[model samples]
Target: MASTSAPARHVPGFSAPAVGFEEPFAMLEACHERVQRTLALLDRLREHVRQQGADESARQAARDVLRYFDVAAPLHHEDEELHVFPLLLAQAAPEMRTLVQRLQQDHVDMVADWAAARVPLQALAQGEIEGFSESAEALFDRFAARYASHIHHEERQAYPAALHLLEPALLGRMGQEMAHRRGAPER
Candidate 1:
């Protein structure tokens, strides 16, 4: 089978930019960029599987997608939930409260979506399946689309509003907590 790995390299934002937790909002934005890259990889993996079957490249792509959505994505969402959303809920207007609530729900929905999406990906990664079923393909599409929309909402609306509300001290605390959770050493 022809290697499909070459295209994976061209997926934008595949290598995340260096953004330390010292700038929490920038870190979160960088996570969004990573999310976009991973989603692109997921789309490409799906296409590759359809055309080329479960080769090593496809297996590696499946593993890559699983690792991101399983580990980093959850941590990123937790950072927003624990640090960003609570602040917005307490201090911002009712509209912001609603927005945070919606975002929180998006996090929940995404977890569920990932649960469903992970099954086929796990199978693909293990080389048990040659390609996604039609239903799995649809699930993948919805998963990627939902993330794209969710990231847009957070970036264009939620992050800016929350950033305006946070003081320097809170930002420092937020950064520290974020780094500590990831087990990074104190700087």
Candidate 2:
């Protein structure tokens, strides 16, 4: 007998349509929006696992979170490292230079934190939420907190500094490189 229950639908945290590649700054902002949504999904997954014990919804959420962080995040970080950070490192004022260095270190810390958080998420994806430990939840909390702070710093300090320093040509080149890195067709 077919189950009468309706198929589960994704509960997205927010809806921010992706912008065009030509608008590189806008694209970065859009990516940040997606990151926020994915992080929220991670938080929801924790609750779902706790309450529902790795049901289909929890499994799906784990997979979604894993896919985003594993795939999209690296590209986004590369976009910042390759396209955004260099300009600030080379040309920004002394105060901004210090900020850029801190931002660069934040990227490294984020990668480590994500590695720690991914273990339980991987288990959750495999319908093994029983294996989720308190340590994993603590790691995830730290990871999410670090990401929030990192995003704030980048949006407030690093991105604006890069925008101010990069002229139209450099910005175009950065966008093109970003698209190429993602295997996306350049517009």
Candidate 3:
């Protein structure tokens, strides 16, 4: 008798729909949603590796996480550094200024953390490893934790404060610059 079980289904990672650059703040917030989803995927990948030992699904998940952090994440940071941070630094109150400085440092730290985390992930994505080392897992944990805190701070405080400070004209200009840098079509 032939088997009747269905083949396994591969569910792709969740990604929020793209928001246009015309709404730059919304675009940034959308990026935050992507960040959270990618991080969740990373967590799932880690667990999958532990149980499944770098199967094709695990490898693909590693690739997805790497691609987002490598490409989209840096651009998101640049969007804030170039457009958002300057406005806050120039006009927001001293407390907000301190928060922005800390956020900037968070960006620096995240870059360093990603550099370390990328190594084992690269090996996994290339089918060179079955699972992460203790140190590598720790690196991943720290990286995710930092991003959680950083995103929370930005969403709760920095974004609202910056949005309040920006006039419509400046916001439009900021959006244009962001779109130009990413080669995104203007709407």
| Candidate maximizing lDDT | 3
Model 2: ten consecutive residues of lowest lDDT: 1-10
Instruction: Provide the TM-score for each candidate, comma-separated.
Output: 0.90, 0.88, 0.89
Task: Give the lDDT of residue 138 in candidate 3.
Answer: 97
By lDDT: ranked, best first = 3, 1, 2
Considering summed lDDT, which 10 consecutive residues are worst modelled in model 3? 1-10
Q: Write the per-residue lDDT of candidate 3 for residues 70-120, one digit (tens) a residue.
A: 877887899999988999999999999999999999999999999999999
Candidate 1 lDDT for residue 126 = 93
lDDT of 2 by residue, 95-145 (tens): 988988888898899899998889888987886656468899889889888
lDDT of 1 by residue, 1-187 (tens): 1111223222222233367778999989988888888888898988888788899999998988888887678878899999999989999999989988999999999999999999999999998988899999889888988898899999999999999999999999999997776656677
| Strongest candidate by TM-score | 1
Clashing pairs in 3: none
- The better candidate by TM-score, 1 or 2, is 1
Candidate 1 clash pair list: none
Q: Name the regions of candidate 3 deviating beyond 4 angstroms.
A: 1-18
Report how far residue 152 has shifted in candidate 1, in Å: 0.7
